[model samples]
Target: MTQKTFLVTGAAGFIGYHTSERLLARGDKVVGLDNLNSYYDVRLKESRLARLQQHENFRFIKCDLADKAGMEQVFRQHQFDVVINLAAQAGVRYSLTNPHAYTDSNVTGFLNVLEGVRHSGVPHLVFASTSSIYGANTKQPFSETQNVDHPLTLYAATKKANEVMAHSYAHLFDFAVTGLRFFTVYGPWGRPDMALFLFTKGILEGKPIDVFNHGDMVRDFTYVDDIVTGVVAAADNPPEGDKNWDGDEPNPATSYAKYRVFNIGNNKPVKLMEFIEAIEESVGKKAIKNLMPIQPGDVPSTCADVSALEKAVGFKPDTSVKVGVENFVRWYREYYRV
Candidate 1:
């Protein structure tokens, strides 16, 4: 493929940072955008941004997706080949105390991106969605074909809203828009609040780690690299309007428009205790466990049905939990000098 330009929102974020790196590595011009919010450590965001800055083809823009004027200005300035919206207020539990943040970033910010894409004539728009949208769902492996009408948390609700909002724009404006529902993504440079980061930090420092759901949870823990692979593949090939899509029995995953949603996750599900053990073995330390009940808006389990992704992208996220945990552990130790 020839050189292309991509506008990656939340460029300083974990998945966003990795996605920008992948695009730059392929000799693509990447205009990265981020608000540099203190949702987590601004220093961590800066560290990731600094590394991306080393690439000559990579340009950084510090702008929030919610800033309508700033976002409009960005679209006006750049002639992007593809626009990937990964910026959002991320966190399941944090949504409880900070509801406004979810609306401001996930809902309002996402709308701004849609408007920008609609007007800018960007051919393709790929944005991040989450498996948390599968709330009140007891299914073993969540499928994209299932109805996601009952989101348990504000964060999940906002993301579900994004999927709905994107579909409308795709139908009305006629452009390819893909939404990826990422399962428990974890790897190097992951968010601090994630289970792996917290468990690794607590184990290395001899502190008690809070194991929610009393260590009986299940997650299809996907490695970040695998997630990025699926993301790029989806971005590369934009889906077209499904001509045979039936209105009688509508498929939730695809629409009559050039829009779709896919689950990007390791098909293998690992128990919470097993995931913790992997981290412990990697760190060579045991965690002082404070097993607690499943918190509000927390699901007991999550497993992704990635068959749609495989058929569409010709790939599946097959990274092993052991290898992924070890990678994160090594990065944590080296980055923090633990």
Candidate 2:
């Protein structure tokens, strides 16, 4: 493999931090960008940045992706061989309460990323999408070929829109754009808003953990390291225009235009209660359960069909939930000195 410089947006984020660190470890130069928004905990973001700053080849830009001019400047200054965009206003329930945040980050910010890549002559652009796009679809083991037209929340809508936008750009500019639809990713240094973190915190504090959908929910609980693995593989293996693709029978997830989407998940959907049990085992404490109705904009379950990703990358995410939860709990205890 050739050594190259990568521009990774959302470097302070869970997946982004791990991706950047992995690249740095391999002797590649990384330019990381993050606004460090207080969506969850700024302290956690700062801690992620602190570790990346220790690497001599890593440089960080304190800016939001919505700042079009600033984004363009970053692109102009660095000739990034690959651009991985993970920055977005994330969270499903948060999208219901604060819809504008999703618009600002997922929509406007993503546009800025597209603009930067468009003008900067970046070869391959890999960005994050989510499984939430499979909204209201009761299908098991969701595939990339499925229609993702009906989105339940603004966040999912924006991500689906991004897929369309990326396809258009690829067709017009010959740019390679690959979108990875991630599942419920969790691990060490994970986001505080995610289920694993929330459960751990609640259990540790003797508080009741809300079991949504009356414990009927399931998730393809992917490990963060596993997420990073798929992301790096996608960036390295950019898709070429599908010459065999015909407009007569259009495929939503692939195009004749150098664009494609893949599901980066564990391909295993675990029940919510089972996930809670894993957390309990990790902490050696049982949770006070508060069974509740499913929140608006939340899906009952998500399972990924990762055959496309496996074929393209020659790897798959195989981390078991038990090992994953154990890793996370260890980190949480060390980080918080609990």
Candidate 3:
């Protein structure tokens, strides 16, 4: 692939930082953008940004996605070949308390991204979606073709809105758009709020770790590198409009326009208790488990059908939970000096 200038939103974020790093490593010019909000740890976000700054080809832009003028200015200034949007108000439980944040960032902010890309004529717009959109559905290994009309949480709803929003823009503006539904992404420099980070911290600190759903939950824990691989591949291969797409028998994953959505995840689903055990082994400490009932707006399981992604990109996330957990543990120890 030829070197291309790219714009990566949420550059300070976990997945965003990793994706930007990969692009920079491959001799691509990257303009990394993030508001660096205190949604989690601002320090962690800053650290990620600092690393990206070390690359001469990478430029950091501290801008909020919701700022229409700022976003428009960014598009006007930079000639980005591809735009990867990973910025959003993340966390399902947090969405329950802070509902408006979801709309502000995921809905309105995503609209700004779409509009910017539309006007700038960016060939491909690849954005992050989530498996949470598969809420209330009992289907094993959620597929892109399934109807995601019933999102349990506001966050999921916002992401579902983003998918439709991108589809509309692709149809009206004639641009390629790919939405990646990431599943339980975790690895080095992972979010502190996520299960792996939280579990490691709590285990090392001798604190009781909360295990929801009575430790019966299952997640298709995808490694960040694997997720990034799928993301970059999707960016490299822009979707052509589905020629066989029928209006009467509509497929939710693809459209007649240049739009598509794929589930990029480890096809293997690991049990919650097994994941906790891996953390315990990695940290060499036992966790005092506070098994609790499944919280509202939370699902018992999430398994992604990655066939579409593999067929498209010739790659699939196959990282084992044991190895991924060990990598995270090593990073946690060194980063926090634990």
lDDT of prediction 3: 0.95
Please write out the lDDT profile of model 3 over residues 91-154, one tens digit for every residue.
9999999999999999999999999998998999999999999989998889999989999999
For residues 82-194, could you state the per-residue lDDT of candidate 1 as single tens digits?
99999999999999999999999999999999999989999999999999999999987899999999999999999999999999999999989999998999999999889
Between prediction 2 and prediction 3, which has the larger lDDT? 3
lDDT of 2 by residue, 178-248 (tens): 99999999999999999999999999999998888999998999998889988998999999888788788
Measured with C-alpha atoms, the lDDT of residue 321 in candidate 1 is 93
Among these predicted structures, which one has the highest lDDT? 3
Mind sharing the TM-score for model 3? 0.99
- Consecutive 10-residue window with the lowest summed lDDT within model 1: 312-321
Per-prediction TM-score to the true structure, in the order listed? 0.99, 0.99, 0.99
lDDT of 1: 0.94
How does each model score on lDDT?
A: 0.94, 0.92, 0.95
Clashes of 2: 0
Q: Candidate 1: lDDT of 299?
A: 96
